[model samples]
Target: MGTADTFIKNRLDERKASGIYRMLKPENSLVDFCSNDYLGFARSAMLKNNIVAEMAHYPDSLNGSTGSRLLSGNLKYAEELEQQIAIFHEAEAGLLFNSGYDANVGLFSSLPQKGHAIICDELIHASIIDGARLSHANRYTFRHNDLESLEGKLKQAKGNCYVVIESVYSMDGDTPPILGILQLTERYNANLIVDEAHAVGLYPAGLISELGLQNRIFARIVTFGKALGCHGAVVLGSNLLREYLINFARSFVYTTAASFHQLASVKMAYELLKEVDDEANVLRNYIFLFKQKLNNNSQYKLLPSDSAIQCIVVNSNGNAKHVSGQLQAAGLDVRAILSPTVATGTERIRICMHSFNTLEQVKLLTSTLNTITHAQ
Candidate 1:
């Protein structure tokens, strides 16, 4: 075999030995407990119909965005949709990116410069970490959700400090004390950037808008894939920030824009979110039900989270996989998140609660989890 092929095989073997090798599995007909469709919009027939209707307003012949926005891809509909979304979120302006990863990588990689500092929560998403690594800014990580640690990092920051965090942490499913962090960042005159991917539809517009902090934030990244059940993301801020990213963010400037249908999906999703705000409440109640059911059972260590994403620590990759397998065998779709997706000893089963999930389903899931965990 070639040298490069042999090296790849060796690496794959190493990953297999560590119990952290990865593989893609097809979707199953198991009970729904492993998706990010918090409001069930992804599976909603109504939502699909709305998207189809909205797409009718655009050119029927258009199959794709011909090029990047700066090229032939720029369309009036796209710009108008951005404005509508920004208005809903109470932001002065917004710029769309092809995906949440693109939005994060573009924003972080371009916004901060040399002699500047980029500080993030230790538990920030991988995309943000990658973006920060690509930038020239000096980078530091505060302890997860620790304002004091964040303050210390800010104090040592040299120039143009930017603090990054997720409104809802993706893995642990917990949230930081955003108000406290905002106040601290204000004190240090640092720009606060929030990625509200997991919190968008679960909280009206997002947690920032729900708290009336839209005017105070320097930038907010809202994704459509999770709660909104759509396919792109937008970075909302002042017009100047939008313009800067339009010109400087390589991810936005270099890639082909999302197609007309994709953009229509985003637009229709937002409209559906407005009409079905009660879905969030139903999802939250399910979250409570699951927690209450498992509360008295001490077999599994449930992570503290008020968000749609719920997690239970299994401590080791093997144990997590085994527990997830047990749940799956019972026709539950719960999956194990092994390291290095999370830390080595912090492998877990990440459960996602959705509005469409029934009370009986929640009960069965909790009971099944308890049984499986007790056996472990």
Candidate 2:
């Protein structure tokens, strides 16, 4: 085999040895417990039918976007929907990207110009971390959700500083004190940017919009694939930032645009979100019920979070995977998030609650978890 083949084989072997080898499994009919579809819109046949019907408005024989949006791919209907989205989210303007990762890459890589500084949380998403690395700006990380640490970093930052954080942290499922952070950003003279990927459908629009801080933020990244149960994301901000990103964000500028059907899916998803706003409460209630079942079981630590993403800290790659396997055997779909996706000692079984999940499912899941953790 070639040298490249040997190198790839060695890397794969290392992952296996460390008990962190990743593989894709076919979709199963297991009970719902590990998906980010907090609103269950992905399973709504009604939403699919509506989206299909909406596609009739576009020109016939269209299988894909002809080119990038800057080229032949920009559909008038799609741009109209972008405006609709911005209005719904209470932002002055919005720009769609092919995916959440693409949006993060485009926004961060392009926004922070040379001589500017980016202060980010230590526990921010991997995509955001990669985005920061791509920027020309100096970057500093404060302790996750620690206001004092962030304040110190803010004070030390140079020129046109930006504070980047997620409205709801992904892995841990905790949220920062956003109002306090906003105050510090104002005091330190830094612009605030939030990734509300996990907070959007749960909150009326997102945390910024929920708090009526739409005018206070520099930018916000909202995704459709999670609670919205569709694909793509948008950067919500002022008209100027939208225009600037369109001109300079290479991820959006150079890549082929998302197909007409995909954009329609995003539009339809938000429309559905508006109709089923009460599902957010259902999901939160399930989260509460699941935690209540745990009831201070000293088996393993359950992370403190009011959101749908609940994590049981198992603290080792092998153990986490084993617990996840046991839950899967019991027809539950709980997933193990191992390190180096997270910190070394924070390997965990990630339980994602959904609006469709019944109270019985939550009880069974927590009971099974209690048993497995006891066996450990």
Candidate 3:
């Protein structure tokens, strides 16, 4: 092999030996327990039909955006959809990005300037961390969900301090005390940016809006891929902030705009979200059932969360992988979150409960988990 190939193979071999190698698996027919489709909109026949119908309204639309937004790809319909979404979420304005990763990366990287501060929760998403890394700002991370820790970081911040956090943490599936965090940010005069990727469809317009804090937050990132079951994301803030990102955020400025059909899907998803309060309730019920099955059982260590994303810590790479494998073998779809995605001893099987998951399915998942973890 060539020298580069040798180096690549050695690095991959190290990952394999360390039990952290990754591979993409084909879709299977197992019971759903490991997807971000909290509201089942991704799998909804109604949603599919609505999107198809909506696309029919724009018969001459392009199959794909010809170029980036600044080039030949900007569409009037895209901006209209952005306004509709922003208004629905009670924001002054909004700007769309291709996906949640793009939104977070674009917002975090471009907003904070040199000598400014970007303070994030230690458990913030990898995209945010990467975005912060690309910025010229001084970066710091507080202990996850710790108000005191965040306050300490805020005090150390310099110019144009921005505090970043997720409304629903992906791995832990828990929410920070948002009000407390917001109060601290206000006191410190820091800009609070919340990523509501996992909380969007489940909470009407997301946690900030649900709490009537839409006008209070500096900026909010709402993703469509998770509960909304669509393909893009939007950053909601002031009209000035939207304009700033359009000019300064490289991810949004350089990437091709989303296609007509993708935009149609997003629009359709939001309409469906308005009608799915019942489904949202069903999702909450399933979450409760899953937690009840565990019942603080000493055998399984389930993290505390009210969100659809639930984690059961198994404490090692080997244990987490084995438990996840056993779960998949039992006709349940579950995946392991191994280090260094999480800390070494905090590796877990991340269980995602959806509105369409039946009661029997939840029972089987918890029972199977009990059996496997007890066997350990």
Candidate 4:
């Protein structure tokens, strides 16, 4: 009907030509190596039962959040849950968001003043990148996990500065040198924000708590959908930050408050995390096993990470897809991380290990992968 239609179609065609086009497929019934259900809570019937038990405790809780938190959507006991979350994480206060993306959008979109600066790692999540893009502050991206590069950018920062990074990067699964970066940010008089999306339940209290550096940094973003096995996220900071975001963060101000069911699910998930405190160690065992098996394979160039997400670079989108397809055919549901998502040369087959995954399953997955590499 218009030039806009033709332009949009051309962009779609370009994606196809570039070997980066994507579409959602039905959930694979293969082995459990592709999901973010790091602890198998998504597949746990006990969690669902716990949700029902939790809902029973809140008779007055509504079927749906009627409006934004500013209006009718504020449910009884919601603030109590927020406080519980804060206490659990050893933070002064907590504010909930519908999802990690919404939280990032709200936080960065609102925080940076006109003369302030937001410096983020280049490989930080797209949500943070989008949020920084929306801000009026001078934004800069340092090389991923390169503290020296971060300092270089910080040297040119104008006003109040915020340094953003993930505790555990989602793509490569490697953790940044958090203490070193924290020292750098402190030296520069900058606030540090850590996205603990993948490291929430993986550490003792968190990476911060495990490092014995609680309340030293500015804020920690914790998401429940991954390790906690539920939906929603929270910003852990001071009460003043909570009040400020409630007032100014557009995503929080304009969106409907999280439903009681979602909030209760978060609560119950934490209860499960505490009840099964040894699960993190169990996950570490799998990571160790996978790495140990891949040892001495001179041709295998898997990324160095101590986390559940293990990536093997395939160099090209075509090759990554082909290898992933071979694995999937062997009954593993691994996925390929393509270019545009990652750099062209760093395209990979991302194998996500879970706590519930069996030792035999891990063995089979590695064996299949090793077979593929040998064929290549």
Candidate 5:
């Protein structure tokens, strides 16, 4: 084989040696504590029916968009979905992207010019980091969620500056101090971008809307895959920004638009978010009880979070993987967040709470976890 292939295989071997090799498992019928389908809309019959009905209206809506959006893939439903998202999020406009990763890479790689700078949180998502790496701007990382470090970096920026962060950290299950970060962004006259992938459907509203910071941020990226229980993502911004991305964002321009069925499901998920109070409340209560149980256990420590994600820090990757495997054997479906995915010293087992998960299931899994750790 090629030398490049050999180099990649050697790297894989090194990862295996460090106990951080990764693999995907087939879907199991076990109780789920690992999926991002927080609202359980992914499997909803009502959503399925809505998508079917919408597709019937456009008989040609099927399999794929023929080509890139700039060519033939731009469908009427794509524009309709963008309008719905902008109205729901109270933004001037919204632009649809195939996924959150595409949206981040396109925005970060294209927006900031050569002399400008990007100051981002160290713990931001990998897609954001990859986008920044491809950018022409000089990039620097501030301490995770530390506004003081961000401000220090802001003072050193030579040109137009952008401060990037996430509303909720994926690995740590914690939120940043947004108000303080906004204050610094304003003081330094820098644009602010918040990736709300994990917070979109779970929060009372989105972080920007709930905190009344929508006007302050230059852009916000929201995904449908998490709480919305669908595919695709949108970038909410001013009309001028929307126009800019339409012309300049390569990811949006080159990719075929999402199909009509996907757009219809996204719309239905938002409708459910407004109407389904009981289901949402049940999930919230389970989260509260789960946290209380973890607090009572001396061996396990839960991170500080009011969102749907929770993490139990198990410092070693091998140990975290071992605990997760035991939980799976006992019929729970929790996932281990391995090193390299998370920082080496902070490897964890990520438990995603869902609206469909029962109280007994939560208690059983946590108790099983307690038993496993205490046994060691």
Candidate 6:
């Protein structure tokens, strides 16, 4: 057999030995407590119509971008979308990437230099970790959301320091102290990069803007796939940073540009998010109620979070997977986040909430979970 086949077989054997082999399943329409479409914009008819309407004004808005963006794929629509995103997020400029993963890799690998140090949270997204690994910078991981620990690491940094974190952590669904992080960044004369993938479109107005920390950070990565109900992500930063990424970020420079349809859809999604105040309010209420219900139930251990994502620690990967499977068999869509994905002893079931999920579904899912766990 070929080298590629042997490599795949070896990897599969390793995973099987570790009891961590994973396989994909067909999409199911069970009550969603797992999708990232927080605002229900993925299925929004109005948003779809708006994209179609925009595309009708330009017939070339379909199909793949012909070549890499550095080549023939550059288009007027991309620039327009980036401008809209930058304005909306209150950044000096925004550069779009194919996905959040691309944005992370592009930013992390390209921003820090050989003499710089990258201090990241131990629990940051895998993409960020991978990017940091690819970077030439010296890297260290502080305790998750522990500013003091990060500060200690900062003191030991040898050169230019970059502090990286997510606004809302994907697995844990908790937020770090933004003001404190910014303070540390300034104190150490370091650059701060925030990945707002889970917070954008769900946070009030502009998340970074709402905190009034727009001008203080080096970059903010806002993703459209999660709460925005679209594909792609944007790295928001200074005009200089945008230009730098255009030239040096391999992920952005080498990949084909996003299609015109995707750009139009992202623009439409942002517009809808801006106008749909009532829907946003409803989502906020649902989140509050969900948290209240989880808190009131003393039987299960819910991670501390105020966002749409929540986790229940089950400790063992096998147990967590079994619990998740039980919930799925009962027609709910909760997912088990296994070890290796998380720390071995910290594996849990991750539940993602959506604005469109009804109160009845939330109540039923909670009750079922309570019963399953024998929670009082």
Q: Write the per-residue lDDT of candidate 5 for residues 1-376, one digit (tens) a residue.
A: 8999999999999988987788878999999999988888888888778777767777867677777777888877788778878888888899988899999999998898899999999999998998888889999899999888998899999798999999988877689999999999999999999999988766745888878888889999998888888988899999999989999988888887776667778877787777767777888898888887764566556778888899988777877888899999999999989878888878788999998898899999878876876225
Deviation (Å) of 306 in candidate 2? 0.8
lDDT for model 3 comes to 0.92
Per-prediction TM-score to the true structure, in the order listed: 0.98, 0.97, 0.98, 0.97, 0.96, 0.95
RMSD, one per candidate, in order: 1.1, 1.3, 1.1, 1.4, 1.6, 2.1
**Total residue pair clashes for candidate 4:** 0
Off by over 4 Å in 5: 295-298, 374-376
Model 3 residue runs over 4 Å out of place are: 374-376
TM-score result, candidate 2: 0.97
Off by over 4 Å in 2: 59-61, 374-376
Give lDDT tens digits, candidate 6, residues 174-254: 999989988988988989999998887568444567788888989899988987788999999999999999999999999
For model 5 the local lDDT of residue 126 reads 92
Positional deviation of residue 358's Cα in model 1 after best superposition, in angstroms: 1.0
lDDT of 1 by residue, 132-219 (tens): 9999999999999998899999999999999999999999999899999999999999999999999887796899998998899999
**Model 6 scores what on Cα lDDT?**
0.86
Q: lDDT of each prediction vs. the true structure?
A: 0.91, 0.88, 0.92, 0.89, 0.85, 0.86
User: Of models 1 and 5, which has the larger TM-score?
Assistant: 1
C-alpha lDDT of residue 139 in model 2 = 94
Colliding residue pairs in candidate 2: none
Distance from true location, Cα of 259 in model 4, Å:
1.0
- After the best TM-score superposition of candidate 6, give how far the Cα of residue 336 lies from its true spot, in angstroms: 0.4
- Residue range with the least summed lDDT across 10 consecutive positions in model 6: 367-376
